[model samples]
Target chain A: MRVPEPPREMYEELEHTADWALRVQGRDLPALFVNAALGMMELAGVRTGDEPGEVRRIELQALDKESLLVDWLHELLVALELEQLAFREIELQITGGKKLVGTFQAVPIISMDKPVKAVTYNELLIQESPDGLEATVVFDV
Target chain B: MTQIRKQDFTRLTPYLWEIPTSFQAGMRVPVRLYADERLLKAALGDKSLQQAINASMLPGLVSHVIVMPDVHQGYGFPIGGVAATRLPSGVVSPGAIGYDINCGVRLLSSEVGLEEAKPFLSDLATALYRNCPSGVGVGGNLRLSAKDLDRVCREGSQWALKNGFANEDDIARTEESGRIPGADPSAVSPRAKQRGRPQLGTLGAGNHFVEVDVVDEIFDEQAAAAMGLTVGQLAVQIHCGSRGFGHQICSDYVREFQPAVKRYKIQLPDRELVCAPLDSPEGKRYMAAMACAANYAFANRQIMAHHVRRSFEETLGGRVADWDLTQVYDIAHNMGKIEEHRVEGELVKVCVHRKGATRAFGPGYEGLPEEYRSLGQPVLVPGSMGTASWVLLGTEGSMEQSFGSTCHGAGRVMSRKRAKKTVRGDRLKAELESRGIHIRARSMPGLAEEAPLAYKDVDAVVEVVARAGIAKKVARLRPVAVIKG
Candidate 1:
């Protein structure tokens, strides 16, 4: 199933005492996932090189939308840490809120000011909103 | 969100407060908080108490959930929270133990006087910053193969010792001798191994650092002498953990436990607090994998200690009479240890989960080294950057009250975002440098995020723990040099 790209009111950083939190929204599940990834990358201060990007395909399955979101973000986090990979462009397909098929243009990261250690499931809930869907995530820094 | 009011708590003592099970639904145990009036107000300002109430609902919890004076809001179980569940069928929540498994502090005392080392502080800081890898996506010089990584998973600090990164004395002074048993490398995921491989000696970013301090005050001369801490002398504190390896292991388990909770029919108020029984296959695997990460952290710190020693030697050897730094103690703040604690007058086996809390085993515990056994285990409490750190000793009160645990650090009072907004990293660095403290940091924004104003006062936190009898102050340390990632 496909939906139009969400509005730019994608994600916003929320205040957390000891960690990083992001309040993310999307017109659809795929948009929500993409925006969440972009929010995390921005929060960590990730910057990429000008070199051409490589399109990579990612297929992931989880118990639910929240789990899928965490798994997806964590996949990007690991790539950023281990391989210095960041997404330049993203195309995600969501099915039943349990499986995700994403093809993102991976670019080499030049630098990241801070490291986002792990994506947490703290108070994590993906709910229906008038706009589409909304969820908040906490990242352990 | 459940709102917890200050008036809802029953003041058990001047420094101890309690929220009985009646205060919330599904609570199996009362939540006990160790905080003075002001700190209690601070606790109420956040959702920490509400999280504590949620933690008390975990299955098989024994006694009460202990909240330290430095308690603050975390995801599910509040940071600076401690809870022990009866063994065999007791539940183990990875979130309660935290993501940075075995994230801890190692304190090494030195005989070199602060005055003598003052001139060389800059060089020492530079040496440390260069020797010990810091910053984001940084890898250490020691690149381990898959087989060697397994050895690290199995041997911990012993591996460092074999590789000349640690000494026998260093291992002897460490908690659990720098290696935890029941670590099965097979239990760890390949992704975790991949992350742990090259980051052994690196100090990754976010609230982690290597700081050189001057022992400014000795609260207990007897205990201080035993730990080789003296007024006017220098000390080094290395604060970090298992790095990416531990984070991955924890993330993997926390995700795995999401469904495990459903399988075991354990109900939790928050999904982050998802757990499995100790006897269950899921729980056993998590424990084994967690131990591997714990051991990896032990080796990581040990290797960093070696680099610290080398940096000290290279910078201060020819100038000072002695530049050697001896291990005072190394203690993990985030961990789940299986031990026996006296509960309700009966010695029972339990899994004590300390998330952002330290194990402060009192005197006479068999786990302590012979010399420290009479004085209790030394607890290393590294303060916020630019603030004073503390050296404390465990007491009988900790055994009876907090499951042999105490506060970890001056817990965060302000959000990192707020800190960055309020304090410019360059300006803060300049201020500390003007105060005669040498600073080496990775990024200005990162430094801004860890501004001292972001955390609670360490002295007040120590006072609360000291008054509560969970830990006793031994020495106070003021930073002279800081190396941050």
Candidate 2:
């Protein structure tokens, strides 16, 4: 599958580094969240390999979608750190009320580097859309 | 997202709103938010209001919980939240102080100007990045054993000065004079100790930075003179905290307090706001441990300041005295203290928790150094990289309005992932450089997350604090070079 390139206006590239950002934009909430996660992995350069390991099941319920998204990413990063797995593909099923259940395919972390700190609410957004949802998230990498 | 009903705000004045006790059961007093219309609207989009309301429900709160203009959602309490609870009756909540206790900024002024430092800016930044320990879990040059760590936790900057890590001027200018009384190292958890052992003098990642700034403007000439700040003078600002040590201590206490809150029959609107009575064993233990972390942070900044001074001396080739580098002030944004404040026309001792906020004591406050006694405490608000940072002074109004507190920094307007998603670190660096601001960091992604666009306008935030009369503007320092950990 061809990886979608982020919108040009969204990210400003840095000097002497492999990292990139999307400063994502979408009309719907779910789409924004999905794109934000995609953008983070893109910065981590997690797109190339496809090992397709065991399926990892995760479920989280937060007070709101914003909190839910933060918790979801935090759990995912923690799992990646502790389980030594990179999730290549994720199947997210959101139950309108702050709960999300997902099944993800793990990619072995052969040479993973860099730890992400806590997720911040800085410039985070979850907007309503006719099609679905859109959001923006900032991760302290 | 959960649909939380916005609470009807009762305007106490043009700048204050009260979250009445009737709004939620178990609230000992109302919660007061200090912000203008714009800030309030922006806050409506976040969970900070809910957090402040939750904090009001904590046990033994003396009066209304207060939120500053720079408020943003944070764990347990709003980042700019302040709550002062009547001691013995009120309880202490570790969450109110935040994970990074005493996470703060320290400003150092130099006799050198931009012209003198312009030639060496890049080398100076490089030297700072090389000498200072930064990034996640990065160890510092000086490793301390358990005994040494105890001295750091208990004595704070005093320990640093004794070991030649700081100078006399640094101590005199530092808040609490580099030591917070009542810090009992024994109260610190073993895990906290282990984490702090090798982290001294290190700048942890995420919003932590060391910037070379030029005093672009001085708002109050008298205050600026007292601070030794002049237009075009060079200064260094170090932004960091107690690191893992404070995080672990907060974690340990938050967990400990959860059970204590239940045992004490303390009703809280949010689980994260768990707290125990201030006089209780649980609360005392938490405060003691919190002080230990606060002291640790003070020492951390002092050592880092020493390293900065050394870097400047090495790169600029000037004698230490000739450098004329001296600490202006150091203030914490996260921590709780037992302080005296007037409540309902009477003097009362209350436990004040300022998370992502700074204490802005006005003139005549006993806590300020003698030199600044007539001027008030200095409040440092650092903007995002490549932006202007400000120095404000405490006012008498702050004592009555915010329990002697003010804003901390330009509150986040974007999440890190969103900022990174929107901006590439390299491009951001280039953009800043093109605009004449030098950028240096360990990770480009880190740089992207801290892009200036990710934060609220520091100018606007400072204006609110100034207009609200909690703090008065002192000086505006613009970054010439920024180094992020």
Candidate 3:
């Protein structure tokens, strides 16, 4: 019997002094959003509580897809700081490469190893990839 | 991205290098670097020089883009980079000032001798950790109403004085008298205000710290005496910024400028470098909002200073006869200021954006305090965790060459990911403790990321600036205890 190959990682951390960066990939725009959210939470070492989580929705519009992705991730970060919520599952819808509507099942954050200050647009460009789309995001910390 | 090579630079002097506009297309002026050959090689290992070159393309830039010896790669602008643009037409990029607006260092000297304070070192560290709110997701002791928050936005350290967090001398020693002019709270976003309301007086995570040190050496007795430094005496350094408030403000502006740049027909190599003309409405509003964050940081440090003084008193009041901590200086390294500087033999007003650089005004500047008018401004250079920090003075060379600025701190050479992968926080803490240094931290991974090996040699960085005549060293401080989040 042949062994199945392990799935590829949705995101990988990049090297940056004084900040954090990650290269995120997905099969579609919505997947890209989901992976970015997960990657950010992972980089911050966020751990969640065992209680049943709550579902929250966010709607945002921006000038472009890159901006929309940033806004989405920023919303998640704000929720992590203000509401102590960490996303367990994320579903996103992209409209016209400018609008994003998303719902996430969030659990109470038990602990975080670090904090990301802000999401940046430094050299940020969403490009075509073998999977579907890819982009590099830098977070000030 | 193009790879930078050593052959690409013109060796102007033993400590200075220049990359003329002829090296690249669309560069408005030359990019000057202050580094010895070895430091220059380290800069070539990263993309910081390229970021400086990109910054040179900004409109109405005067002289050249100045890169300090400790320069490192940042998102839009290189850390330890300085740029001045002519007013009326020049642009002010938010990234050039950094996300943590007014992120700075405050040094306080004391009459307490190291011998007298030795027994209370551990207790002092514990007191400081308990008194100062730190780490991620921690709220401060005071909650502000909307009106009181606005007062902090406008009044800066004066708000702390009114609230009994600071004395007049502390304000006098602070940069811009602990408050920048024209801070309009109305211009700040509601989201930023909400974030600022809860985070005041917090030393947020990611390299922000409070360290206690002993004056190990004094390079200049006159200058050191003027700043209240004495060998074998204890001192405290508070390093932090505006916290979530500043981050949200910078994020809001950087996002808003994505559209404003298009409206102004501004062309930038990177989207993060997006900016607006200083005379434009967008630029004016961003400046106003930035001032609010700047003032907020000033007040934050003032309140932290109060707690630090209390911590000292609670631990060593009777043990040491004179345990009072006096203000040496408070200066911001990450900021954008409107000032007058000579360009091409003409005195011109410009906006000097110092991302990871400190304003090092030399002697004879009227803005300095009366005691320091002839002694020049005090420039505090904090090292990475478990290293020697320096006290330096601004020089006339800084006024002439680097727009009244000098290196901020020991710049990072290794990435956080690489550091965390190779170093264990528990082992590092044990090592430091064995060296007689006390450590208090909330996160192991965060502590691992700030290991000393991850940064450049601060002594080497200071030597480059001193040899270049941009700044003069005064004293060296050795860490005895540290508190971090």
Candidate 4:
């Protein structure tokens, strides 16, 4: 599998902190949300290991895609703590009108470095894009 | 990329503007902004306007929602936003008070000047950092059992005083005498209690700090004198709140409010602004929980002040009494109170939700201590680290215009992520040191997020607040050293 680099032009360099964020552009809502989530986890160097032992499922529905993305991530975090499972990757399928169904594969919890505290709404952006819909988000963790 | 168009404003006066209720659906009142041309323009470039507009949609809001000059975008409401809603008829929103309930600033004045304390600057910073618990998830030295935690929640700063954490003078100087009435420990969740159990006196990370500053200038001589502030004197400012306790409480309630808003048939422009009627079960629970958190914060700061005094005594080789280290004032920024404010000619009890805004009640208000009756409440505005903080006195104008509210601080201009990308923490630290500002922090990344450049100019923010007549500047304080969690 090949990992792709996010486009450089999509992100502006933040002046005083230590992370990078990408302003994602997409034609569809689901793609944009997934890209934003990927960008967030990428900044923190989040990755899943190959040792899979358990299957965890999380579902969320919100009024809009922007909020749906937030709810999705929040659900994932809660699952990580409650189920004591560490997942390497997620497969998300959005069925319009604020509903998203996803399947997550997980392994036994291992010692992890750098925990995310909570997500904040500061500097959150969602806008119309030439391709579809676009958004940028900054998480507090 | 598409460029976002700016909204038009209707000027109500020299310092006020109207964001008409018609601007958005479900808005109960118009949004009022308290800022001049420059500040307003800067605010337009940010998301403060959108947040304020969203907050105006809160249920049962009266007259107009207000934002101070230092307004900036925040969760649920703009950081400097204020809204008053009729109690029982109106609703209480946790987002209005913010996650860090009663997050506030406490100023301590000392007779010693910067020149006298220059030689011991490092020692003082080290002492304070050592004595004060800081960093993410760190516990303080004083551990509390369930019984004691309940007492702290119920009594607030009064509990601290009873436990030898403060004195009578400190109590008199504190806002609300360090305890807000109506706090019921039983109303608070067990999770929140568990979080608060070992965290009293701890400084949680991200914008929380203890700074040593010099009184650089006095804008109003008589007011400054009355506040015991003089040019060149040294002072300490501690900025923190209820930590995980408050955060968990807000999280719990924001989730709980979702269904409450729906059940009440309420409409909102933003879901984050979801609320419940003040008289409803959920609303009463939130207020009680909020009071618990507010009291926890008051106790937290009182304990920190005690530690600060002890550190000073230990470092100077004697009691700090001769140093004249006394409590100046403590004021909450993120809170919602049932206050009596005149609305359209009637003195009605309204729930004033001030998120990232300060209550600057004028003189003669019944809440203030007798000693400060003539002087009004002391409004402490802490600037970003390496910038000039200020002490201002509330004025009658505040009551007339803003429900007795004022700007909180030098609001953030740039996002923390943006700031971190532009400047490395190490380089920023070195730059500040070059300019003679010593900074001690638990993490370099944390320090980077709080770089002074990330915020609006404190001088300009203070000037606008003073010129607007809501608050009168008494003293300007320049930082000598900062210890951040």
| Best model per DockQ | 1
lDDT of 3 at B432: 96
Question: Model 3, A21-120: lDDT tens per residue?
Answer: 9999987788887788888998999999778788878789999999999998998888888777898666778899898787777798999999889999
Question: Where is model 3 more than 4 Å wrong at Cα?
Answer: A1-8
How many clashing residue pairs appear in each of the predictions shown?
0, 42, 0, 15
User: What digit string (tens of lDDT, one per residue) describes model 1 on residues B1-485?
Assistant: 45788888999989999999998789999999999999998888778888999999999999999999899999889999999999999999999999999999999999999899888989999999999999999999997999999999999999999999988999999999999999999999999999999899999998899999999999998999889998999999999999999999999999999989988999888999999999999999999999999999999999899999999999999999999999998999999999999998999999999999999999998878888999999999999888999999999999998889999999999988888889999999999999998999989999999999999999999999999999999999999999999
In candidate 4, what are the lDDT values of residues B225-288, reduced to their tens digit? 7667888888889998988778768767876787788899987766667789999999999999
Candidate 3 chain B has its poorest 10 consecutive residues by lDDT at B1-10
Ranking by TM-score: 1, 3, 4, 2
**Ten consecutive residues with minimal summed lDDT in candidate 4 chain B?**
B1-10
| Alpha-carbon local distance difference test for all models | 0.93, 0.77, 0.92, 0.77
Once fitted onto the true fold, the runs of candidate 4 whose alpha carbons sit more than 4 angstroms away are A1-141, B1-7, B318-321
- List model 3 lDDT by residue over B238-339, tens digit each: 999999999999999999899999999888898888898999999999999999999999999999999999999999988889989999999999999999
Distance from true position, residue B447, model 3, in Å? Answer: 0.5
Off by over 4 Å in 2: A1-141, B1-7, B318-322
Q: How well does chain A score by TM in each candidate? A: 0.93, 0.71, 0.91, 0.65
Q: Candidate 1: where are CA atoms >4 Å away?
A: A1-8
Give each candidate's interface RMSD in Å. Answer: 0.8, 8.8, 0.7, 5.6
lDDT of 2 by residue, B286-404 (tens): 88888898999999999899888888988887632356578899999988988999988999999999998999999997777777899999999999887889999999999988899
